[model samples]
Target: MRTVTVEDVTIGEGLPKLIVPLVGQTSEELIKESEFISQLPCDIVEWRVDFYEKVLDFSIVSSFSKTIKKAIKKPLLITFRSKKEGGEKELPTEQYFQLYQEIIQNGQCDLLDIELFMPEKEVSETIALAHQKGIKVIMCNHEFHHTPSMEEILSRLQKMQDKNADICKLAVMPNTPEDVLTLLTATETMYREYADRPIITMSMGALGMVSRITGELTGSSATFGSAVKASAPGQIPIGELKEMIETLKLS
Candidate 1:
């Protein structure tokens, strides 16, 4: 798989990159959180803009993103997850597109995460715009309901790559041990067969924690870990996750 590099950090090269999501409701809160996260041992910091109270305001959102950009030395991933995708709030598709375009034009982040479920034309246009600006994209899909079969998982992942994503990411909720295995199986298959770019796959909640720890073994290039609070279900704490991945590397 090809690596996605932002600054000096390479996603597909070694151990899965540790990503910490910044969940703040206010600009002040985000600034404070940025300061705190800069001290953590994380390779990337994701700004969950859907959780920010002032995201609908263009000025506030733009300035706040720039502030956080200056505060962190590592790569910043900007994600405005929609409510349908298990995010905090909802916005119309036009609004979502405009907001993302604005961020890309302003160069606010190293990566912009666009959902795979979005309208096809819009997704392609935005991805083209992002690439023109030299911004990488992690085309994503979150199935908080249930993990699909291994076949479905592989198909969905291949579609993400086909859409010209710099990285393909999928997160699912698992109901049984087989569900976790399904996600892992899909991860390996996608990497071995379909992917031209690195992949990020996780089966969420406690039953799927194994997916988070086993990324390197299964060919995933990134894993999300919690800083102060987990932005997603089943995230292992950043400190513990770092220790686990590091130990695994040595062993």
Candidate 2:
């Protein structure tokens, strides 16, 4: 698989990289969280803009991106996760595209997360803009209710790859053990057979937490961990998650 280097961190080349998410509601809270996360042992930090009180204002969101970048040493990954995908806020489709466009042009974040289900033209255009500005795109799809079939999982990932995304990510809420297995099976198949770029996959919630730590085996290039609070269910704390990844590291 191709590796994506953000600053000095090279994902997809070693143990799955740990990504800590900041879910603060205001600039002060996000800055405080960024300072704390900078002291933690993780490869990247994600600011979930949907949780921010001023996310709908493109200028304020761009300003916070700059502030958070200064507050953290780790590479920043900005995500304005849509409420359709279990996020805290919902943005109008046009506003959503505009927010990302502003951020890409502002050039503060090292990476950006774009939902895979957005309008095809807009998704491709935003990704291209990020690339032109030297930002890696993590094309993502979240199944918050239930896991899709292995074929469905692979199809989504394949579409991401075709879009020229630097990384492909999928998170599924597994209702049963079998659903977790389906997620892993799709990830492993993608990594071993089809993927030319890095991919991250997780079967979410307590029932499927095992999938988060087994990335080295299942071929996920990174895993999300929580610092102050988890943006998603089943996110292990960064400290424990780091230890777990190290313990399971393949020699």
Off by over 4 Å in 2: none
lDDT of 1 by residue, 11-130 (tens): 898899999999999878888999999999999999999999988886677667888989977899999999999899899999999989888876488999999989999999999999
Which candidate tops TM-score? 2
lDDT scores in order: 0.91, 0.92
Runs in model 1 lying further than 4 Å from the true structure: none
Measured against the true structure, the TM-scores of the candidates, in listed sequence, are 0.98, 0.98
In candidate 1, list every pair of residues with a backbone clash: none
Native-to-model Cα distance after best TM-score fit, residue 243 in candidate 2, in Å = 0.4
Tens digits of per-residue lDDT for model 2 on 31-58?
Answer: 8899999999999999999999988789
